[model samples]
Target chain A: MAKVLMKGNEAFGAAAIKAGCKYFFGYPITPQNEIPEYMSRELPKIGGCFLQAESEIAAINMVYGASGAGVRVMTSSSSPGIALKQEGISYIASCELPCVIINVSRGGPGLGGIQPSQSDYFQNTRGGGNGDYRTPVYAPANLQEVIDMTMDAFDVADQYRIPVIISADGMIGQMMEPIEFKERTGRSLPSKEWAATGTNEEREPNSINSLYIVHEDLEKHNWKLDAKHKLIEENEVQYEMYQMKDAEFVVVAYGTTSRIVKSAIMDMKKEGLNVGLIRPKTLWPYPYKAFDEIPKSTKGILTVEMSTGQMIDDVKIGNNGRFPIHFLGSPGGSVPSPEMIAEKIKNILGGEKK
Target chain B: MKTIFEKTKGLTAKPFHYCPGCTHGIIHRITMEAIEELGMLGKAVGVAPVGCAVFAYEYFNCDSYEAAHGRAPAVATGVKRVHPDSLVFTYQGDGDLAAIGTGEIVQAAHRGEKITTIFVNNAIYGMTGGQMAPTTLIGQKATTAPYGRDEAHAGKPILVSEMMATIPGSAYIERVAVNTPANIRKAKKAIKKAFEIQRDGKGFSMIEVLSTCPTNWGLTPEDSLKWLEENLMPYYKLGVYKTPEGGANNG
Candidate 1:
C-alpha cells in the first residue's frame, strides 16, 4: 500500500468510514471542525449519513440513538464540547451501547483556549459522566497511529458493548502525516441481538435502556458491567516498551508527549544514561504491567504529559512505589520542548536517591 | 359476535407505572393505537422521554429507545436517518420537550427531519416530584414554585405547537387535548396524521397533546379534566397551527 499524506482530522474521519461506520453526528468545535467538515463531504459520497447537530449534547444523543438501533455510529468534539456531552455519554454507557467518540481535545477547565492539551486525561479515564462506568480510551501519538486507533476503536467498542474514546489533543488532530491505509481483520464482532430494531411478531420488542430503578436489579446490572470491564482490563492492555532490557530509569508518557519524550530519551542515551520509554496506547486499562518489566537497577521513573501531571498518578500506581517517581508537565496549551524534557530527565538521574 | 373493541396490539402487556389517574396511560394507548391503525407497528421505532413516561419503552410494543432528558428528538433524528423507511417518533413531556430539550426539538423541526413527535404538555414536571415546567401556566402551583408561578418572575407558558408552526420545515403542527372522549378521538386522529406524514417522508410533524398530571395537580382525574378544559385549553388554544397543502404529502 502506498502511503498517502493526510491531516489528522481527515484521516480520523476516513478511518471511521473504513471501520464500517455509516452514521456520524457532530457539532463543530475548534481543532476538530475538520472532522465534521470532512465527514459532511465524504460520508455522502459513500452513502452514509452525516448530520451537523444543533449542539454537542444533541450530537451524542444522536449517537446513542443510532447505536441503540444497532448501527456503527460516531461523534467527535473538543474539550468544552465533550463536557456538554457528558450527560448523553452517561446514558450511552449505561445502556451498554456500542459507539465511538473522538475527543480532539483542546485546553480547558472552561473554554480555556483552543490549543493542544492532554488535560482531558482524567476526564477520559475517570469516566467524565455521572456513573460508575468506564469508556475504553485510546490515546494515539501521531497521525498514523490516529488512523489505526480510530479504525480499531469501532471493533473494540462492539466487542465490549461499551463506548470507546479516541483521546487525541489538538496537535495530533491538526498535524499532517503520511500513512498507508490497511483494512483491519480477524476480530469477530458479536451479533447485535440486543439492538432495538423495530420488532415483528416473530421476535419480542427490543428496548435499549439504562434505567434500572429496582435496587436489586440495578445491583445486578452493575455487577454484569463490572465483569465485562474486568475482562477488558485483563485482555486489552496495550503499551510499547522501548529499550527496557537493561534500563536504570523508565520514562512513561503517551500521546504526542511520548513522541517528544522519545526524542529526549535518544539525547540522554548518547550521554550514556540508561533510560527507556514506556508509552501507553490504552489509557483506561492503564498498562500497569509495563512498569513491572523495569530492571531492579532502575532507580526512578518519570511521567511526561501535556497536562499538569494527570497521568503521573497512574504511573506511580503502576510502579507501586518500587521506584521513585517524578513528573514533567506543560499545562494549558504549552508543549514541553525535547531539550526541556531532557534536562528534567537528567535532573531526576542526578537527584538524591529516594 | 364480532369484536367491536380490543386492546391495541401496538401496546405491550407490560402495565404502565404511572400514578393512578395520570393521563400518560391514555396518551400511550392513543399513540400506539395510531401506530396500529397506520399498520406501522412492525416498522415504528419510538424514542421514550425522561419524565413520567420514561418507561414508555416497556409499554410500546414496537422497538424503543429511552433517551436522556430532552434529547428524544435528536435520538429520533438518528434512528430516522439510519433507517429511513422506519417510522420514528418521540414521545416527550413538557419538561423533556418544552424546557430542557427545547433546542433539540426546535432544531429537529427546523431541519425538517422526517419524523413524528408526540409532545405532551402537562404544564408541570411529574417525574421529579412536580417541579415547575416551561409550560407551567401563570399561577400554577408546583413544588419548585411554592408560591404559585408568578407572572412577573416566570413569564408566560410556552406554546410549542404555535412556535413550531412558524418553522418552514414543520409540515403539520396541531394542539389537541385528551380531557374528554371527543377530544381524545381528536388527539388520536392528530397523532395518526402526524405518523402518516412521516410515512410519506413529508418533513417534520408534531402533535402537541394537552395532558394532565393528576397527582401533581392536586386534583382527581375528573377534576383534572375540568381544569385542563378551563385553565389549559384557553391558554394553549387547541387547533391546527399549520397544515401543508393537500395534506403533509405536498412537502
Candidate 2:
C-alpha cells in the first residue's frame, strides 16, 4: 500500500482492522475520540463491530467478553477513562484474556488537561488495577510506528494470552503524519482453546474466570502468571540504539520523547558533543539490556520523559548504580523541544562545548 | 426403572456453595434446565456476575465468562455480538444488576442486543454479608440499613422488571418468583421464554426472579419462603410486563 497522510488515531483504527480485529469497544475521551469515531464510521463497512460503551468500565468489560470468546478485540481511552477501566483491565488480566488496549494519555491526576502527557507510565506498566499482574506496554513514537505496533499488538497479546497496551500520548493521537501499513502474514498464535466460545460437546465447557477462593489455589495461579511475566521480560525486550559508537553520554527515552531526543542528539552533534539514544520500544519488559551495552566512553545517562520522571526509576534500576542518571522532563502536557533537551545535556556536562 | 429425575447435563458436577434456604441454587437449576431443555447446552455462553453467584461459571455446563461486578450485561453484549447464533445470557443478582450495574443493564436493553438476562433479585447482598441492595424492600433490615431501610434516607427499592419493561428494545420482560412450587414452575417457564426470544433473535429478554436470601434475611428457609410469598409477591407482582406483540419490534 502507498503511504498516506493519516492522523495517528485513525491509523491505529485502520491498522487494527487490517490485523483482522473485528470488534472494538471504547468510550470517547479526548485526545483519543478520533479512534472510536473512525472505528464507528469504518468498522461496519468491513463487517466489523464498533460499539461506544456506556462508560469506560463497560468498554473494557466488553473487550474482556469479546476476547474471552477468542475474537480479536481492542479498546482505547484517555487517562481518567483508563482509570475507570482499571478494574475491568485487572479482571481481563486475571482471566488471561488477549486484547489490545490503547491509551492516548492526556494530562492527569484529575482530568488535568486535554493535551499530550506520559503521566500514565506507572499506571500502564506497573499493573494499574489491583492484583499482581503486568501488561506488556508498547510505546510508539511516530504514526508509522503506531500503525505497525497496533497491528503487532494483537499477535503479541495472543502469543502470551495477555493484554498489550499501546501507550501513546495526545500528540501522537492528534497529529497527522504520512504512514504505510505493511501486510502481516504467517504469524503463529496460540490456540484460544480455552476461550469461552460455545462448547461443541467435543470438549468440556470452557470457563474464563479469575476467582480462586482457596489461598493455595490462588498462589498457584499467581505463580503461573509470574512465570509468564518472567518469560515476556526475557524474550520481548525491544529497544533502538542510535549512534552509540564512541559516545560519551547516552540519552534514555521512549515514545514521543525519543523523537525529540533524536533531534537533540543531532543538534548536539553539530556542536561536537557526541550523545546517543536508547529508545525502549517495550515499556513493561523494559529494554533493561540496552543499559548494559552502554559504551565505555559514556559518562552519564540522561532520562527524558513527558512526565516528571516516571520512567527514571526503571532507568536507574537498569543502570545498576554504576553511573549518575540525570532527568529532564516537562510535566503536565508540556513538550520539551530539541533545543531544551540539548541545553539540558550541555548543562549536565558542565556547559562543556565539546 | 425410569431415570426421570436425574441431574440435567446443563449443570456441572460441582455442588452449590450457596447458603441453605437461599434461592440462588433454585434459580441456577431452573436457568440451566431452560438451557438443557432448549438443547443449547453446547451452544450457550453464560456471563456470571459478581455476587453470590460469582462462581456461576463453574456451575453452568457451558462456555462461561465471569464478569466484573455490575458489568455482566456489557460483557454479554460483547459475546452475543460476536456469536450471534449462540445462546448468550447474563446471570446477575440485585447488587450486581439493579444497583451498581443499572446503567449497563439499561443500555444493553436499549441496544436490543439479542441476549437474555436472568436477574435474581434477593433484596440484599448475600455474599458481602447482607448489605443493603438497591432492591431491598422498604423497612428491610440490612447491615448497612441496620435501623431498617429508611425510605426518606435510602429511597425506595428499584423495580428492575418494571423499568426494563418500559424499554421498547426488550422483547420479553417478566417478573417471577420461586417461593412456591407453582411459582417455581412459572419461573422456569419465564426463563424458557426469555431464552426462546433470544434464540429467535427477537431482542433483549429479561426475567427478574424474585428470590430469597434466608441467611441474610435472618429467617429460616421456610420462613423466608413465607416472607417472599407475603411481602415480595405483593410488591413485585408476578406477571409478564412486556411481550413481543406489545412493543419489542416497534423500537
Candidate 3:
C-alpha cells in the first residue's frame, strides 16, 4: 500500500509477517525488544502465534520446533542474547531446518553496551555455535533494506533449508524511517516436503535429527552440508560498488558502517579526494569479486566499523594482500563520525601506497 | 491366529539402541503403544532429548525432532503451538530434564503448554557413563560422586513430578516405575492418560517413569529392577500428584 514511518525493530516483525510467517518466539533484549513486542501485539490480529520464551536458548529452540513443523518462523535478540542462541542455532543448522534470526547489533565480549555496534561479524559468518557450518547473513544499512531483506530471508531459508540471519546495528534498530511494505514476488521456493509435520500414514514419518553416531555417516552429512555452502558461496554473493570509476582508494564496510562510509566518501569527494565504498550485502558469501573491481590506481582499502574491526578480516581475505589495508574503529558502541572517517582516508593518502 | 502381542504401528522398524536390561526400551515401547491406542500415531510429533534416547526420533513412527540438550520442552511448546491439534510430546531423561533443562520444562508447565513429557529418571547419566545427575540420590555412588552423593555438597535429588504439580498450569503430573509387569502396566496407563490430557487441551501433562540403567548402575538387569523398586520407588514415590479438574487415570 502506502509507505509508513516505522521503527527498525517493528519493521522486522512487519516484514516477517508480510513474508507469511505464522509464528514468532523470542525473549526481550535491548534494541530489539520492539520486534517481539510488535509481534505479540500484531500477530494475533493476523491469526499468527507469538510466544515469549524463558530465555534466548528456549526461544531459538522454539524457532526450531516451528520450522520443523513446516511454518515460517523467526526470533530476534541482541548481542549477548544472540550468544545464548548460538547452541540452538547450531542445532537448527545441523537439522537443516528453515527459520529466520534477527540480531540487532550491540557491543559485546560479555554483557557489553546497549548502543549501536557491529561486533558479531565473525560470530555470524563463521558459524557462531560450533561444527563446520556457515549461516547466510544479510547486513542491511537502512530501514528499507531491513524490510526487504527480512521478507526475502524466509524464502531464502526455505529454498536452502537453512537458518538466515539479519544483522543490523542498534542505530538501525532504534532509528525511524519511512518504509513501504512492498509485496515483491517471482521467488521459486521449494515445498517443505521433508518437514516434520504429521505423516498421516501416507508416507514415512519425517525425522529432523542432527546426531549421526556412525563415523562415516557423520562425515557424509558434513559433506552434504559442505556442498550446500559451496553453492551458496558461488550463487548468493551480493555487494555494491559505490562511486569508484577511477577512485584513489576503496573503503570496505557494511550495515551502519557503510552508511557512514557513504557520507565520508561524499565529504572526501568535495575535497578532490575520490574515495569509494564497497558495501557487502551478504556476509557469509562475501563478495570477494568486489575486491577485484577496485581501481588499479587505488592505494589500498580502508575498513571502518563500530567495533575494533571484526569485518576487516574478511576484507583482508577478499583483498588477498593485493593492497594495503587501514582500519578506523570505535568499540563499545561508539560510532566513528563521517569526519573521522574522512580524516583517516586523508591520512592514508598522505602516506605512500603500501 | 489372534495377535496377542503384536508391535504397535506407532513405532518404526528401527531397533532400540538402549543397553541390555536398560528400561528405556520398555518405556519407549509402552509410550508408543499408548500413542497407538489413543489413535494419535498419525498426528503426533515427538521431541527426543539428547540423552540415551537421542535416537528416539528414528524409532517414533510420527513426525519427530531431536532437540538440543535439555530443550525438548521448549521445542515441544513450539511444535504444539504450530499444530494445535496435533499430539505433541517430549521423551527426556533425568540429565536432560531435571538438570540443564529445568528452566525450559518448568516454564512449559508454568505456561500450561498442552503437551506430554515422558521423563525417564534413572538417577544417573547413562550416555556419559554414569555420572551423577540431579536426580541421583544422596549417598548414591557415581562416576562424579565417587564416595556417594554428599548431601552437604551436592544436595538431595529433585522431585520433578511434585515440583511440576505445584505449578498451577499443569493439568496432570504422576510418578511411576516399570520394575515389574504390574508396574509396567500402571506406567503405561499413566503415559496414556498424559497423552489423553494433552489431546483434550488440558494444559501440561507429565509422567516421571522411574527407570533403570543397568550398565550405569553396575548391576544386572534383574538387580537393577530390584534397585529401582527398593531405592527409587520409595524416594520418588508412585502416585498422581495432580490432575485436571475432575480428571483421573480413568482406564
Question: lDDT (CA) for every model shown?
Answer: 0.90, 0.91, 0.91
Tens digits of per-residue lDDT, candidate 1, A1-354, equal: 899999999999989998889889999999899999999999899899999999999999999989998999999999899988998888888899999999999887887899889999888898679978998999999888888898889989999999999999999988899997775585888999998778755588888888998999999998999999999999888899987868878889999998988888888888888788999999989999988888888878888888888988898889887888888888879898989988887777777444
TM-score per candidate: 0.97, 0.97, 0.98
What is the DockQ score of candidate 3, to 2 decimals? 0.87
Q: Please, what are the lDDT tens digits per residue for candidate 3 over residues A69-136?
A: 99999999998999999999999999999999999978988988899988888778876698988899
| DockQ for every prediction shown | 0.79, 0.81, 0.87
Comparison by DockQ, 1 against 3, better one: 3
User: Per-residue CA lDDT of candidate 1, range B77-120, in tens?
Assistant: 88888888999999999999998899999999999999999999
Write the number of the candidate with greater lDDT, choosing between 1 and 3. 3
List ranges where model 1 is wrong by over 4 Å: A352-354, B246-251
Tell me how far the alpha carbon of residue A283 in candidate 3 is from the true structure, in angstroms, after superposition. Answer: 1.0
Q: Candidates ranked by lDDT, best first?
A: 3, 2, 1
